[model samples]
Target: MNLKPLKGQHHVSAITANAQKNYEFYTNTLGMRLVKKTVNQDDTSMYHLFYADERGNPGTDLTFFEIPNAGRTYRGTDSITCTFLRVPTDDSLLYWKKRLEDHGVSHEDIRKGGTRMVLFFEDFEGQLLALISDQGNGGVKGGSPWARSPVPQEHGIIGLGPVMLTVSDLGPTEEMLTEVMGFRKKGPYRLEVNGENTVHVYETGEGGNGAEIHIIERPDLAQQRPGRGSVHHVAFRVEDEEELRRWIQKLKEQRIASSGFVERYYFKSLYFREPNGILFELATDGPGFEGDEPFEHLGEKLALPPYFEGQREQIEARIKPLNTKSP
Candidate 1:
């Protein structure tokens, strides 16, 4: 059967408190580019900021809705967990270690993840995040924001490497990831090559979503409360709107609860919750980050989707300024 899996890890969007700080931490500190600065279709009071590679490609993008008035989210056993990006492993993270230090960014020293080096940290919103790699996935070039990671442009962030998630029920979510999403199961979870520390692992395509979307199965953990550190939602990609619509119907037929298609400007999104309670979104691939501004000055302007075409001024006025600030 021709699998209709996602194109790759398109992007992950989360809710944040300060759009500027979020932009700064992602770009200035992490070396990701602020590819897009748009307004949320549902609530214009917030800004939808996108961070991605050089060209603002699909699978390499990460987005956020800066909700200033929003409260803090909790991060722990019941949370959606951290998102990990892959960078060249040969001394690349060494630069990152000091980069975090020079910027005064708080982070734990390098940690071990199977055969990879996993450095975990948190954003201003307290959202758990990490950078992990076993030498990056070949040639995926990324826009490096810092001057330190001078290992050359051939190796930058090769898109999301892995995403760790905790859940009460892994059955339905597993079906969606492998069957519906088309990821190949690597095998039973393995954290050690010799079978010391084992953990679930799955793979698909190349480096785009590279070995990502990890689910931590712990039914005994209590439910999480949403505040400052929880992940809002994770988005998988479909080639186009037609593919998206097709899945919308397929999801319904599969008996998996789903949401109506939402036109999110750059791309349309369909939201739903896995049985374990983590929100999952299937978003389209097109209208990439360049839809609003040129790659050179992508985040400089106040970009708004067609939904907010006429209300741009009012919406812009309502939203407070942050690093992703605009006119």
Candidate 2:
């Protein structure tokens, strides 16, 4: 029997000190829409903002939470960090380089990949992140508002291709990704980022698309200190809650130790720390994001889960508004 397809990545959450700067980068510079603007139910002092293509497509999202006074956390072998956005192949890079340059936002020169081209940049908190040239392979739909690069609505990042981590041991982590998560190894390899060791990498394939998970093997690096402005976790998709149970069984059978499942509104999640200290989540696919809000206005306004709705006034008042002047 064929293994069921993972729901694919839903979205990645990043911490941002200057939610405003993060806002401009995702919206104005990167050409995405601010789908949701709500408060973190856990700590409503800041805003949890979401950005994505029209309709707030799942794979196309790059969301952030605004935390102005958070300290810069250290990243090392134990951290699974950064989110990459994919654009059409035609001329997205030219558009981005000029856009960032025009806004005086710092960005690197175009980075060429075997099949994709990437440009890495830091968010306000120095969080490592990038925008990739997906070359229209993913069902990228809708043209971006950024005029520099025009892509017919069909090549944006369809889903997360890969996420990079620096782990102390590759064994358990590899087991989590391949055996537990269903990613097939395309074999170990090196990625020629600028012809230099931009990173130490291992490649895995899902369906036909490939994702390279990088691990920096230096012993000097320490484990991650998670906090605002740092990545809290990375999530992978399962078809439904039933598949979720199977994943739980697989983890137990393998003695991988999980933190148990947690309800995340619209999706159920189970978290476990791989051997390297990277937080990985197994999330369900059904009751898709659309289950919460109508597709047409997924992120139009502050739509809270029914559970959180009772605290709207308190939540709204607690979060400081977007700083219009970040970055």
The candidate scoring highest on TM-score is: 1
> Judged by lDDT, which candidate is best?
1
lDDT of 2 by residue, 1-327 (tens): 234645455567777778777777665555566666766656766788877666554445566777788777777667766566666553767776776677677678886644467777766566777666767443323224222212334443333545667666667777766676666554344554323434544443243222445554545666777656687777766667877777777777778889676776766878887776667777775465576677655555676778888888887777665643211
Candidate 1 stretches with Cα past 4 Å from truth are 1-3, 134-156, 188-198, 206-211, 323-327
Consecutive 10-residue window with the lowest summed lDDT within model 2:
140-149
Give me the displacement of residue 191 in model 2, in angstroms. 4.4
Q: What's the lDDT for candidate 2?
A: 0.61
TM-score for each of the candidates:
0.86, 0.81
Clashes of 1: 11
What C-alpha lDDT values do all the predictions have?
Answer: 0.68, 0.61
The lDDT, on a scale of 0 to 1, for candidate 1 is: 0.68
- RMSD vs true structure, all candidates: 3.9, 4.1
Tell me how many clashing residue pairs each candidate has. Answer: 11, 9
